[model samples]
Target: MNRQAQAAVMFLLGAALLHAGATDLYLRYVKAGLQPLLLASGAVLIAAALATAWYERKRTRAAKAASASASASGTGAGHTHPEPRISWLLLLPLLSLILIAPPALGSYSALRAGTALQKPYALGTLPAGDPVPLSVVDYASRAAYGQGRSLHGRSVRVTGFLALDRTGTPYLVRMALNCCAADAQPVKIALAGKLPPVLQPDAWLEVTGTYSPKATHDPVNGGPIPYLSVTSAKPVPTPHDPYDETWNN
Candidate 1:
């Protein structure tokens, strides 16, 4: 195919990938680190298309002029014209991406995982209130402040997969990661209230209650840590590519 046509196809594909990466559906369902790569690739494809188009146009113009002049001189009538060099267009996209580096996934993703924010917690049984979803970051941040002492008695809903302990009850849960599953930290929560009937590994759940601090020694980190006391619990489906909790990109 001609350089112009090839470039056009590449540009279209690049645009489509870029659009998908920018959307929430792709961010949620697709891999987390892929968005930036897509964006970078798209930019490169676009640049390549533009360069190819320009080069082809110039070559065509030059070829046409040469043909016209040769035909006028009656010396090019039996001569065959050589194909234009279009390979240089291939470097356009690559050069564009190299020039403008895309941003990499960073701590913002972890913070968005819901472990960074501080929330108020209630003492004893939590009073009936509206349900609010709390992320791991939120629970962790509040617990970091020494639990219920600082929360001032507020209820929150937490959701994640059920990570069962040896006792069959899900005492700890973790957010699955596609890129860094091993680094997944357990969202420490206390399930003292009504617990779910059947605990499924990696089963999603929505828990609502005031943050009542529980004295639990961290087994992994080897330290004393606070856990959220769940008031209500229900099963939920695990999200596709659940690792990317934040849609900052």
Candidate 2:
């Protein structure tokens, strides 16, 4: 492609990066912490593209003037370059980002995962709330490794999408991201009591339950899978940032 097209592509790509960083669209692909880096990268790309375009235009004008003077003197002008056209393909991802943004990963990954997220470093005493709220990752950590000492008496509330095992046993599940979706691990707590009728697959829900000492082995990795005795449950809208960053935390 010509220099002009290269500049245009760079500008579009930088704009896309800036847009993603400036808004929640980026949360679908990366953590909140990377926003600053994205914005910086976008600015650099846009500046470089603009500078390239300006220089190319000035050089083109100078070349034209030189060629005109050469023709007036009856001398030949310099030859132009003929670069490959494959560079035009660089526009595909930019167009995809603009027109058809990809959706975040959901239950399809969680249910088939080889294992859940690793246990947190340390779990403190359950906080003071009638139904104490916790991330699914935190609850799983408390339930499995810490022996539910903090969870025994207090009712707990957590939110995540619904998934079922091969035997149709329901679970409250969330995808735990260490970095991005590519490295996401499932954080699941089995639901052992009555739930909302016809719980749709991958539907987000808020569940209030009591932690049960009884546990099951992970079907894939043979680790402890904690149980939550469902006392109350409700369907909820999907969260803006669907990942549980507690793993990163």
Q: Highest lDDT among the candidates is held by which one?
A: 2
The TM-score obtained by model 2 is 0.94
Model 1 has a clash total of 14
In order, candidate lDDTs are: 0.56, 0.85
Compared with the true structure, what per-residue lDDT tens digits does model 1 show for residues 84-168?
Answer: 5575566566455434433323322322243212233522333466564556545555565544543556778777555544555
Best by TM-score: 2
Per-prediction RMSD in angstroms? 9.1, 1.6
Give the per-residue lDDT digits (tens) of candidate 2, residues 26-63.
88878777789989999999999999999999999998
lDDT of 2: 0.85
Q: Candidate 2 at residue 173, lDDT?
A: 86
TM-score of each: 0.53, 0.94
